[model samples]
Target: MSSTTTEVLQRKPRNVAVNTNPEHGLHLVESDVPEPGPKDCLVHVRATGICGSDVHFWKHGKIGDMIVVGENGLGHESAGIVIKTGSEVTRFKPDVVFFSTPPYDGTLRRYHVHPEAWLHALPDRLSYEEGSLLEPLSVALAGIDRSNLRLGSALVICGAGPIGLVTLLAAHAAGAAPIVITDMDENRLQVAKKLLPRVRTVKVAREDAAKDLGTRIIETLGTEAELVLECTGVESSIQAGIYATRFGGSVFVIGVGKDFQNIPFMHLSSKEIDLRFQYRYHDTYPKAINLVNEGLIDLKPLVTHRYKLDDGVDAFATASTPGARAIKVQILDD
Candidate 1:
């Protein structure tokens, strides 16, 4: 067996870790420590940001084609330190660490091994908590890129969750003015308002949202938006985004929703609204790190809750509960 396969097969059952499955929700379990392969590094996880997708998987056992089989580690938005480097891992020194992403066991554990290519050096100015945010920030950057947002452009963002709020911040950094954001949860919208006092917040329901939200966006901003970011992925919000956008504008879908959503394609075509979609992300980490280091974007306020690794269950519960007042829940390893 290869080093990777041997490591998984040889792990002791008493190693404390977080395990998730459809049957038992999330619970603390003892799992074997992972061994590093060539070009791999064993990292000691310090902080892991709980993302909406993690909550979705914990609650529903799947997000589209990605499913949790047996007992799976649950986290991707994480930062950690390199404790051991594989024989061929020259890219990362012992001082480096990185955030976790897909197709890898998550970082909600004491230690995990990942390829050196996925590793990025944690800036000296950032704490583990802040570093954990890089993954989400990168997603926001990708969405901003897809929108082709310009400075001082009128913009509307649907959904005020973590992704929505980050997009709002990214837009602000890119000089999007008079930004408006909407969500069904008033608490989340309130958080958005605090982030940018000038940002207009709209609370609208999916019930007849296409008409009501379009009108609300127009009335609030005094005109249709030049760029509409449909971050909610709700069918209704997608439709509202089409209606709320101005002629020749763009509607960027940043949120992951059902496989098939019913959108007003004919209306969007008629208005010459450009429909754009941003899948996860690509090559956004360096820029995200730069923006944070420059103090141009503040991610600290978004971390509303912190839980110890032992409290993984409660953390997921809090994240899943609507109106629980959690913007971002981070799981920390001491």
Candidate 2:
């Protein structure tokens, strides 16, 4: 072993933010740094972004069938430095900054053992926080790819949350024009407007009817949208996106909601609208990296809050809090 790797292993204690249980909540627990397997690389986690799914698991202890029965680390959008590589690993070596998403035993720790195949080399131009953002950007890219968005395509994004905002950035870069984003939070809407000055914003109340909101979106955009990116899994938002889309257009559902939802099947059938769903993402990291590296998408504005690794509980609290107005809360090492 190299002296640098040995030094890292000896000096760094793995302080992992674990979801112990719904009752006990998130806690920082110390564990010994793990060794790399034959196909694994030991990463010194640098920055980890708090995701909505992370919050979901933190609060409910499960997302559908994926449950946290015992203590589980909770972060997927993460970037780090490769400190040591396994004997069989050849794709990467020590000191290479990389971004990755591990299943449940996540990257929110000082030290992490990850499969070398899953790690993407983050460019020097992108910060660790920006590298962490590649995970969500990948989701946005998947949604856009499914939508078949074209140049000058009219688009409506339901929910101006982090996913919606990233979708907007990706869609805009892809040449989708006259985009309108809807949100219940005015602050989030304002953030969206600030991101794209030409993009329209709509604020809808929780009690607003889907059809009525749909009509308002059409009026705001001056025409039915060619594509609707349903970033909010809310029933009303889904229905609104369906109503706002033009005949034969597509509505891509990117958000995770309840197990079942009531849909206006007759209306959907009548319009001949194509309904699609996003199942996480596939083969998107390279594309996402290129988009950022080329300066086509700016992810820096999205990170609204930052905290040290030890203050992870507080970071999660701020992220889950609505009034905090945090778009992306990241926990950094050191």
Candidate 3:
């Protein structure tokens, strides 16, 4: 079950937030701090990470058909502190608050009221910023878990964005060897290489990705990958993933793409490739939090930009700018 606090806001302290409209880019808005109902808790948002989907909404006001009809906030990757809880709530108390998935008003605001079932305690080992990263980390872990990667399995990640980088680290932890990553952006490729020096990195050319990626992968890594994780929604990158996977191997599509995409189905069938896909996540929060606490996956390096809740405009502007070299932009509540 899910619900947004936007509807039941109280007319007292003005809660500042950033909203995205189709015509008006991203602008600040004020709303009343919401009060929790039975089984719900009021959260004082501390840190919110800007996601690619958030940037997509800020720039185009929609991701595919999920457009901003009137006024909408833009943030889901978040962590905060629970200020109060309803009489019926049992699981959560006054402490650090966990985050939830989409279809809600988002966590860009200073305050939020959400159900206790959707909340998880922020571990003492992780800061609010690190806690916010659990969302994307969960996405990467879900995709990797579905790929069924085994020890010493050759892995190739298409697209070196936040998801791809996380997959690289997770694959290493899962015992995948000689990993190779591909991306068109030189900066992102450099960041990935810096993070994992042993893994091979490839910069995809401007031409057809599928036609050229296979040759490059074979040349650099000595063979087709046993598992190819596609983290970019770009059509060419998805095509490259199919071409880079070995026969009988799997190609896990983790990126959210357009409603329709044309792919080479014949090639996939002839190669006996297992084409898989990933949704947001499921049953991954505890595992992710534990992994980070154990230093198994490092997410702090991914946060390349920071902003205050008051600098909503500049923050969204930096996040929406193309090739900004910003892997993750975080907003700290004032």
Candidate 4:
């Protein structure tokens, strides 16, 4: 190995953000820099977007059956530079910016070892922050692909969170018209309006009936939505999406929620609305990267807040706080 590679390999005491337990929440812990396996690449993680799933794990201790056993690192949406590649690695070299997801310990750390196959090289034009956002953008693209969104197809996005907002951008770029986004928080709705000035925004209340909210969504669109991307994962929002979708329309569930949710099954059946669930993303990174590189979609506006790796706890707090109005909270190594 070269002297530079040896030096990077010897870097010590990496800072990692971990969810110790429900009581402790997220905090930084020092760990020895990990060495890459034969097919792994050691990455100098530059940016990691705090995902909603990470927050859910921190707040609730788990999502469904995936319990946080012991100390669990809590980030997945990440991009970084490959400082050292394993012996078998040939796809990437040192100093290449790439987006990656480490299967076990998360990427909310300065140094991460990721499998070579899992890494996708990011273009020079995109910042590490923008590259970190590809995971969520991939999700949005997957939802759009599943929706089969056509030009001028009326659509309803059930939540104005990061995923919902990215979906909004993807759908807009795909030529979906009269897109309406709903959120209980007026601040988030305002952000959505700012992201897409022509899009309609709706302020919803949890106490209000789902059917009523659905009616309001239809009214805002002036017609039943051909596609409803349910990003909230809330039972009420799912019900509202079901009610708002026209006959034969699709309701794609992209949000992760409780193990079981009560829904208006009969209504969904009667309306013949296709209820599809999104479990992360599948083979969308290339398309997502191309979209951003081609200027068809922009992910920069979604990063409303940024924090250094040492302030990981504060970053999670800002993301979890309702009043913070942070669309995407990113933790940076620099």
Candidate 5:
């Protein structure tokens, strides 16, 4: 083979993954960095956000059936720069920072791989720190989309967590007239208020969401919201969503709570309201990036704590803390 060809091929990456077994917490091992196949691009990791799912794996060694076996990487939300691309790659080139997540190797290290379709160019105004946040922001956009949110629609979001706060921002940006947020954590609630100055707060536990809070929110908002975005997957929040939405409005389920909840199908069935289930996100990153680019959405506040890649453990712990009160915990790579 020619020396030039050899040099090009040698630059291709193999993948090294962070593995967690059922018996161990976090174990680091090295493997070949991954090389992109056609339609895929290789990203040099810049920032990876610690998510609740990662913490679940670290503590319990599992999240549902997504067990971390030999050589499995655990992370799904992050942003990074593209370093290599396949022959078929379009819309991006080497060194372009973009958002990568889910069903793709996470941006937790120096390198990760994802399809071109899964990546979105970070806005020029968005830093890697702000860019990593688009993943959660897209989720909030998905919640807004699922709720069929329209202009002047009133919204009630349960849980002032990151997802909830993002939903609040998305709903507000989408021109939903009135939005209310609820959470048990006063600190997180305070952050939510700062992040979204317009969002009304309710200090109610998950279990009491339906019973005590539903009617009160309706009275406060002057009408039952036409849309209820359930960012807290807690059972009672689901109940509140089913009961609190305007008789013929929609409820968007944005959070992943315990396996399933005992939903009030009677009220839902009788009310003829749509109970929409939102998945991670599809084709919404561009809009999310635009939202950030235009200043319609500000993500910097969501990042309450920062760390380097090596501090991943502390990052996950802070993320998992019930009341660390941080909305987003991010890890940066030097």
Candidate 6:
């Protein structure tokens, strides 16, 4: 818990995001903590979660147009206590937790400043680890919202990562029936089955997932899918979701894919299915907090490992490697 400054500029070095190159991984260097301007709150980060998107940036040095940003502060999913509140700040106390920030200097630090709009007060039942996951959770919930999940509806979600699992959790809470989840990773599928019992877990590769899931549901239930939530962003999986969906069904694209994949839209066009793209969340934090408060989504078991700020580089490495047996990797500063 020692903090000093490097004087990269004239200001404090503890707050500088020095990763300008996307190809290189992050390093824990010193930079200045800028003073909060009006309408901003200074957050003393306690925990920051390394996301898969961060891993892609670390390995490739770019995500679409948004690069890691030199010395790239590598974080976005985070939670922390309020240290300094700007003149216009409201809606949170000093000890509250919040999340879903895009890592400009990331939450892996002693102090950082952000707008009050993104901060959501953590309920007593939710931990900082859970709070830090609001971003991905929003991606899940947004899929549910856009797909119009309702009682007795059927949903097939591809890629049993955090977003897929959370989408399964939300679908169950929304009273969707026969929720189906698919992943090639047996371990991931097992974890999802144990953590979330509502979703029927299936092991299907991108090549066979569509016909596999579609055939099973089509034969057993005698009905096509009402909605498809594609959480993998893999090309074949995207086509799988599109093909498996019932006529006039909706597909919500929630994963962060930096590449383009060939999606055979013949089924979509012939079936007249609706395909919607869901990007980074907007106006979903409060509902996310409420969802956690109302017991709609349980995020406790989602976090598989924890590391410290100094080990952030390894955290990204861990997040980048799927075989590391990590679900949601978190970084703790307190």
Candidate 2, 250: how far from true, in Å? 1.2
Report the Cα lDDT for residue 208, model 6. Answer: 71
lDDT tens per residue, model 6, 1-334: 1122223224443552313254475666776666778888777777777777667676777666665555656677778776667888765753333332234545556577878776777877777777887767877777888778889987788888878877877787888887778788999989888976656766775457555656764444345778888898877777767776888888888877746666667768899999888876677777887888787788888889898777776777777787898888888876
Best by TM-score: 2
Candidate 3, 1-334: lDDT as tens digits: 1133333343355688877775756788898777789988888788888888887776666666677676777788888877667999877643344442234477888888878888888777788888888888888889878789889998888889888898888888898987999888889999998888888988888785575777688677778889988998878888888888788989889987887998889999999999888866788888988899899988899999999998978987887776678888899984
lDDT tens digits, residue span 246-273, model 4 = 9999999999877888988988888898
- Best by the lDDT measure: 2
lDDT of 2 by residue, 43-102 (tens): 888888998988887777777677777677788788888887899999764322333222
Candidate 3's C-alpha runs over 4 A off are: 1-13, 93-103
Residue 214's lDDT in candidate 5: 80
Model 4 misses residue 319 by how many Å?
0.9
Rate residue 313 of model 4 by lDDT. 90
lDDT of 1 by residue, 27-111 (tens): 8876666778988887777788888878777777777787777777778888877766788877654322443223445677877
lDDT of each: 0.81, 0.86, 0.81, 0.85, 0.72, 0.72
Q: Which window of 10 residues has the lowest lDDT sum in candidate 3?
A: 1-10
| Residue 251 local lDDT, model 3 | 87
User: Which pairs clash in the backbone of model 5?
Assistant: 13-33, 14-32, 14-33, 14-34, 15-32, 15-33, 15-34
Off by over 4 Å in 1: 1-15, 91-104
- For model 1, what is the error of residue 273's alpha carbon versus the real structure, in angstroms, after optimal superposition? 1.2
Report the alpha-carbon TM-score of model 4 versus the true structure. Answer: 0.94
Q: Give each model a TM-score.
A: 0.91, 0.95, 0.92, 0.94, 0.86, 0.87
Rate residue 48 of model 3 by lDDT.
86
